[model samples]
Target: MIKVESLTKTYGGFTAVDNVSFVAQPGRVTGFLGPNGAGKSTSMRIMVGLTKADRGTVTVGGHDYLDIPNPGRHVGVLLDASAQHAGRTGREVLALSASTMGLPSSRVDEMLDLVSLTESESKRRVKNYSLGMRQRLGIANALMGDPQVLILDEPANGLDPAGIRWMRGLLKGYAERGGTVLLSSHLLHEVQMIADELVMIGRGQIVAQGTPADLLRESGTFFRAVESTQLVEALAAAGIEASPVADGYRTDAEAIEVGKVAAAHQITLIELKLADGGLEDLFLELTAETQRESYQTGGAA
Candidate 1:
């Protein structure tokens, strides 16, 4: 288990993390979500003893990371995938880590196979590797020690669709085998599909933390009908206002409620289902003030 309590960090007058606290439990994949510069990376850096926190405590399992006998053996971290030595082969990189961790050279081969990095690909220099391949090598290196906890920052950044799917399965399987995972990313939709629990942060503070269902449980229902004008009129008559969304109308009312209204008016209901856009809507709503948008390709925020 990974626990963070009242963590705070600042650089000069700028606060990067503020009184933040959350747990990434064993047997679960926890998503650390936020917009860019919302303190996710800073917090993770502090967690792994990379950056000093102004205050509060973070521990993997039970002891401080620095105090652990061999921190990498207990907490696998992949904060920057491109941080590898450009001159070394992928296999050479993993071999170095395995050697430092006192593991046999066979362990390096194990990791390469685990990450599906073919023998020929593993022999190529890191500088020649694509971002996706580098990411794979990074993951293999992180798992080189067979750590109990994993802290990753945007591991899916450069992955293709299939690679993303493979990574999702790998992390989920790791958690299922009783490892703790705390992954940070701003990719909202991707995180929703993989995380068992979510911790959302903005402006250096946590905004929400809970299971997807707990935070997004109230996602409104969607309604559609063949009798366009008549359906809107019927719902309005019943005092259940629905506004246009997608190819249909969405409302706070339950599907049953909307269905009953349509049935009562003899309107041909076409579609009635749960609105699947709740996570995105909630993410936007919570981070509206913290988000920065660039209007044009070269424009500044």
Candidate 2:
């Protein structure tokens, strides 16, 4: 539902986003992930036409965001919850958003209830609302138009664990109902749990994009184990190589096949385990080297 092509953005000499491209498909939640200063927010801004890209284009359902008639009716964005008016009550703010979008005032009330803020402290100014409450109000505002696409940057920030889980379920429900969701967050575990696909950026470039499982599978770690003392011989016979692990062997062979080979050779199974590399492990490994390289370059300078 959302497509970005070679989107590039620069400020003076600093490139904030560089030739990044990715797609957010309908009926799926796509996680936009990157480290701090990795251009996630910048890219999001460009996608929504809040910030113009130096090069490339972003389209929502084949129309440029700026050119889309009633863009808010098609894309619900919560890039910054704090961007709301501090003096207005949450209901007032949502009502205003609804009015601006030519949507019914009833939608504002529905969204407030949806976000569980229907009985919020009556007549309280937004400045008095807790961060989490404000965040919920922001979500309500985003939902006022019943947009088909949601672009939420750190929607889980400041939310309690329960609230975070609620948010996850909400997004999942939205996607299940055919809405597209693009979520940007620093919480890898949350993203790992919720995202159907991942778009990972590093230093303003897309380092990886795929299903979380696919990315993890590609970068996954493998373990090789053997039960008998003739471990090296068994591996050689099977045309496999093994490396010494802590009190065992670590090989990039399938555990079931390895076990079958061991059993065939009468190798007693002492210890055997497969270490599947997960999303967090793979994400760290992929981004850590880039951080180290940047640190080294900075030190040299």
Candidate 3:
């Protein structure tokens, strides 16, 4: 539902985003992941037309954001939680957004309840809201138009554990209902659980992009541990090499197959652990290399 093509953004001599391209499809949460200073925010800004791109294009539902009729109604963006006026109440802020879009004022109350901010507090001003409350209010404003495409950056930043879980479920549900969600976050674990696919960026470029399972499978091998004092010998007998792991030997064999092999020899099966690389491991491995290169270059200079 959303496509970014060769999106480039430069600030004078420095390039913040460089030829970055990706697609966010409906019925799945597509994660936009990168470390700090990797141009995630810059790319997001360009996509929503908040910041003009130096080159390339972005489209939501086949129309550029600026060219779309009622752009706010076509795309809901929550890039900054503190963008609202501090003097306005939560309800008033959302009411203003609705009015700007020519939407009904009832959308304001609906969104407030949707974000679970229906309860009025003594400190009702935007300035007085907690960070988490402000984040929710931002989300409420984004939902005011009930747009098909949702673009959020670090939506769970100030949320507590329960709030984070709630946000995850909400996004997942939205995707399941055929809405397109493009979310950017540094929280790998949460993304792993929430996103169906990921676009991983490093140094303003895409390092990898694929389904979480696909990326994990392609990045490394899964090993199953078979505990035996004769592990090395058994592996050698089976024409397989094994590596020592925390609990037992790790062999590049299917877990069940390895178990069968262990059982055949009566090797006294103890523990069978599967060692598969995760998103965190892959992200660190990929980005660490970039960081190392940058460090080396800086040192030379």
Winning model by TM-score = 1
Q: Which stretches of candidate 3 lie over 4 Å from their true place?
A: 222-277, 290-301
RMSD of each: 4.2, 5.1, 5.4
Q: Using lDDT as the measure, which candidate wins?
A: 1
lDDT per residue, candidate 1, 1-301, as tens digits? Answer: 9999999999999999999999999999999988889999999999989999999999899988999997778889999999999999999999999989999999998999988899999999999999999999999988889999999999998899899999999999999999999998767888899999999999999999999877776557777789967988888888988877656777788889988888888889888887766577667666767889621211233
Model 2 agreement with the true structure over 104-180: per-residue lDDT tens digits: 87887688779888555525789998888888998887777889999999999989999999999999999999999
TM-score for each predicted model, relative to the true structure:
0.86, 0.83, 0.82
Give lDDT: candidate 3, residue 48: 83
Clashing residue pair totals per candidate (backbone < 3 A)? 0, 2, 0
TM accuracy, model 3: 0.82
Winner on lDDT between 1 and 2 is 1
Candidate 2 clash total?
2
lDDT of 3 at 270: 63
Error of 3 at 102 (Å): 1.3
Query: Rank order by lDDT, top first?
Result: 1, 3, 2
lDDT of each: 0.88, 0.81, 0.81
The residue pairs found clashing in candidate 2 are: 224-250, 224-251
